[model samples]
Target: MIGLVLAAGAGRRLRPYTDTLPKALVPVDGDTTVLDLTLGNFAEVGLTEVAIVVGYRKEAVYARKEALEAKYGLKITLVDNDKAEEWNNAYSLWCARDVLKRGVILANGDTVHPVSVEKTLLAARGKGQKIILALDTVKNLADEEMKVITQDGKGVQRITKLMDPATATGEYIGVTLIEPEAAEELADALKTTFERDPDLYYEDGYQELVNRGFTVDVEPIGEVTWVEIDNHEDLAKGREIACQY
Candidate 1:
């Protein structure tokens, strides 16, 4: 199985730093970047090959590719997403559809969390869960969170950003385990999503899976701190949470 990372977004909210580099390259723990942490986690879980979708200052990733490969001891393949700046991540992820058909551990490049999240998903693979999302079932729901409504807290019923916070069971932590079986179907769904709207998020792909008959399950990382770097405040939270990792 290869590791897949979506690091194409420009992250305009984080100007200056994002002016020259993607958010994944932003340093959170001293000089360690979100890309570093993600690759390190993949290494911990024994993922030796990784595919990264890059855009919006793709040169920075190309410049560091050799160093990143040497440090992580993994073969790196950079996938280009020309629409990364023009569209949202549904297209960014669709750009990696060819890679996703293989089993993969996918992590958003701008999220910071511990390696334990990787361990959790790897362990849960035994349950025959084809598509498993790392969820924070204990965190307080917010409007900005990618919320989920599950059936019996086991099967995902719906996942969306527009859901009312009061009805959400938890937040998807931007990490996922996609088995080879689910990846093909997921790629199709992502295509349908992007064709429907260019601004849709990949979370919308999860909704597409649910709309069909596929079951998308969850692995709750209870009380394990994580932060999605969206803005300056999230970056602060990411820095604080990253230190604990």
Candidate 2:
């Protein structure tokens, strides 16, 4: 499987940093960027081939592509998302549909997490599940978190930010393992998701999968230090936790 990163979003809240670079390019640990950590984690997990979906100041990534490849010792491919500034990540993810056929360990570009999370997902592979999400059961869920609901034995029943936090089982930590067998259906679902509402998140696409009878399982990454950088506050927290990793 290859490493897939969805880095196409325009983080308007992160003004100065995101003005010239995409959110993933924002440095968290000295000179090491979020994308750098992601690539390093993928390489550590034996996924030497990586694909990144780029937009919203994608030139920054292009400028560093060769350096990133050499530093990570991995082959990198870029997938373009033209609507990155106008639409949400459901379309950004769908833009990488061709790469998904190879199966992928997908990491959200703006998240900072340790290699153990990748290791955990890899360890849980081949368990008869097509789509596996990394859930943080320890974190206290809020309305801002992308929450999950699971049935007793049926895996994930719903994933949405709009859901009541009190009813959630855990929070999806912006990491997922998508098996090759699930690519076509997932791509189709993502297409439907974005076509229906350009503002919907890729998590909505996962909801679409569940609505179509797909079993989206979850692997709890027990008490991990991680952050999804959205605004300045998140970036500050990301920098603090990134060094620990």
Candidate 3:
């Protein structure tokens, strides 16, 4: 199966650090950045092909991918989302539309993770379910993080951005294993949502799916080590997590 890494975000939160580089290339643990860690983990999970959506500092992302290929012989496909500046992550995700079918493990390039997380998510394949990693919020989450609201146990009733401080139980890590058919349906819903409202974010896609009566299987990871490097402080914490991984 193909692995898709959503790395095309402009990373406005990362600011000056991302002024010259993409957040995925930010240094973590000595040499391994989120980009490297993500690709390496996918390789360990038995994914032979990877498609990465790149935007900011796209050349640097390409160079890193080339270096990884030389060192580990990974086969990676790079797709550029030219609208990265104008669109959100859903745009980056759509860049890999052809590869996202039939349950590919989709990850955000800004998250640091242990290789086992990759294996575990990939194992969700063939379960005939739409699986999204349900991450326990270690601390207070911000407005941009996707929060999974559980309903009826074992089901995700809604996945939304922090609408209010009272709305979230935990965060939704970008790591997800979705069946191809489910993804296609979600993509169509996302397209409709976007056509109606151009400013819709990625979480809106999940909300739309949930509203349409789709069951989202939650794969809970009780702090197995993952970090979303949304800011400089987050980057520091992500570095520590990278070392442990």
Candidate 4:
């Protein structure tokens, strides 16, 4: 399996830092960047080949690609997202569908988390599940969180930010395991999702798959520490989480 990262967004909420670099390159623990941690986690989980979807300020990623590869001992492939500044991540993820068919453990580049989360997803991949989402059932979720509602104790029924937090079973952490068999379906779903609305989040793509017959299962990472870096508050939380790791 390959490691995939969607690092395409401009993250305009983060001003000065994002002005020169992509959010993935933002530092949490001094010299260690969000991409650094993500690559390290993926390498720890035995996925040494990683594909990063890059868009706004992609030149920064290109400049540091070699250095990052040498540091993490990971073979990095860059997937360009032309609509990154204009469109959302559904299209960004869809850009990688061609190469990720072997299987993939995808993580959002702006998220800071321990390697244990990657380990959890790798362990759950053994269940022969087609698509598995790493869910944080223990987190205190709000409306901004990408929430998920499951069908009974099994598959994901819905995943979106618009859903009522009260009805959500848990938050879908920015990590997902897509087996080889499900990659094409996911790509198709993403196409449909982007076609419906260019501004849809990638979670909507997962919802499209759920709308079809695909059973996207959830693997709960109970009480684990992680933070998705979006705004200044989230970046602070990410630093805190990274310090623990």
Each candidate structure's count of clashing pairs? 0, 0, 2, 0
Q: lDDT, candidate 4, residue 43?
A: 84
Which candidate has the highest lDDT of all?
Answer: 2
TM-score of 2: 0.99
C-alpha lDDT score of every prediction, in listed order: 0.92, 0.94, 0.75, 0.90
Candidate 1 runs further than 4 Å off: none
lDDT of 4: 0.90
The better candidate by lDDT, 1 or 3, is 1
Candidate 3: how large is its RMSD? 2.3
- Pairwise TM-score winner, candidates 3 and 4: 4
lDDT of candidate 3 over 51-148, digit per residue (tens): 88899889888777777776655788899988787877765676677776745788888888787766666555566676566455564677867777
**TM-score, one value per model:** 0.97, 0.99, 0.89, 0.98
The model with the greater TM-score, 1 or 3, is 1
Query: How would you encode candidate 4's per-residue C-alpha lDDT over 72-92 as one tens digit per residue?
Result: 899999999999999999999
When 1 and 2 are scored with lDDT, the better candidate is 2
